[model samples]
Target: MDLQKPAVEPQQPEGCLVVAIRMPVRIVVLVLVVPVRMVWDGLVVVGRFLGDAVLRPLGRALLWLGRVLLVWPLVGLWRYVVVPVGWVLGRLGWVLVVVPVVFLHRYLLAPAGRALVWLARGVGAGLAWAYARVLTPVGHAVLWLVRYLVVVPACWVYEWILAPVGRALAWGARGVGRLLGLLVSGVGVAVYWITRVLLVLPALALWRWVLVPVGRVLAVVAREVGDALGHAWRIAGHLSRAVGRFLATLFRWIFVEPVRWVYRTVLAPLAHVVRDVVLRPAAEAARAVGRTARQALAAARETVRQTRADVRRALFGEPRERDAVPRREPRPLGARTLDSSTTALTKLTKD
Candidate 1:
């Protein structure tokens, strides 16, 4: 995409200063950049782990909680309560306001508008009739009189006297214009050639012979400098990455392996022993005690209930029974929805 760059980048010509400066500068930059890059990598790992394990799920749960606590309730309020209320209000407004407005428009305003339209039509028609009867004939007479008194005489004078003079003047002006145009065109051609020889050719020669080659050389130098900087930065990145890998390996050997060994060989067995021997027996004893306590409390509750019943019986003897009441049925045994004698009688012995 970069027109200055070839499809395959060739090795650039390095000057003495570039060769002298490259090694020391890279070494210094590497020393300065290594610690920063390692710290940046560590932060990146920690950030990714935290985002994956903690922040992502926390954010999703918070989003769901917000929808439950805030969004759903508001949506329900708008859907169920607000929508119904608005619909009812709209109906009420139509009944109370719009109905009357429509009735007034149809019954009162419509007739008034029609009356005004009819009156306007009548006035327009009267005006049209008056214009046709009075103004048209008067305008025709005035036009005829003006044509005889002024227009006819003016036209005759223009045709007979002024026409000949205008033709002679036009012929004279045409000859003068043609002579001047020829002189001006000759002068323009001479001026154009003189300026071209004096200015344009010299400028063109300077651009073609002098500036182009120098510009091309400068462009090549600038492009080479850019490529050199890019190449140096890429090499430095590779060196920095190698240094980071070495540091990681050293840290693993010096600290991580030793800690992992200690955890596996020492703490793991001790934790298992504590779980199997001491903590498990203590938990079982606690659970047994809780079961015994619950049983005792339940038995005490039963004894108290029996004692309370005996005391109530000693005080109140027995309750009385209620007297029986008769049931009230709605209809007689033979009654129905369609009663007899409601329909027409049939023959007594029909087969």
Candidate 2:
């Protein structure tokens, strides 16, 4: 056995030429796309910052200004001016046009229409009387006269003189129709065969023997070309993404890491110092001032209470002995009452 040749032919997904073209093309595409992706990423970052930090607040301010400047004034005008004007116009319309139209329809047009309808009914009654009493008898006499003078002779002529001649003519018509049908059928058959032989057979043979095979070949070529383009695009996309990842890593190392380090080492300490040295002292001072004011208020309250007691002692001649009040009370069996304030939270009123 000669081992030089294989038993089966090897198949490859694509040719060597396609691979040769695809690799360099992918590299070129990656090179071209890296800068564009970087720009897109930077723009995305900028747009996010602007939208979150600047544009959103600006948009809110503009919306508030628009409401204040345009919307509120318009709403006030519509409510205070336009609404009253419209109500006045509606009342005027009801008084002037609608009332007059209603009056005309109710008082004038309704009676006129009713009178005209009644007159029409009287005329119709007169016509009905003429038809029932006078026209009916005259119509019957006229019908009898017409039957003898015109209709009876016409009917007799149709039955005897004209019917037999019509029947013969109808029989001739049937015979002529059959002959014409036969001639047309024969001509139709010949034309059908002639058309089939000249046009249909050739067209069918060309479609079956020539055009179908050519279409199949063209379809296969188009499918392969489309598949090749798809594979190239997919490979290019992978390469471009890889290049973009590499660029992102490079940018992070070169720019973001140093910025983060600076913020952590430098700016964070400054912020902490400001908080501890300035903000904390200011907050503590505010609390101290609040405590002084609260003490002053408590002293004033105690002074007022003592003054009220002194006044009572001076006017009402010495204080009486205090009475002990019970904290809890008993209720009747199966009877319950609801109160606004809880006895545990507030002092209950004595009866």
Which stretches of candidate 2 lie above 4 Å from their native place?
A: 1-77, 226-237, 271-351
- Per-residue alpha-carbon lDDT of candidate 1 for residues 90-121, written as tens digits (9 for 90 to 100): 99999999999999999999999999999999
* lDDT per residue as tens, model 2, 120-238: 99999999999999999999999999999999999999999899999999999999999999999999999999999999999999999999988976665565565454444554455
| RMSD of each candidate relative to the true structure | 9.5, 13.8
TM-score, one value per model:
0.62, 0.56
Give me the overall lDDT of model 1: 0.82
True-structure lDDT of candidate 2: 0.83
lDDT of each: 0.82, 0.83
Q: What's the residue-level lDDT of 178 in candidate 1?
A: 100
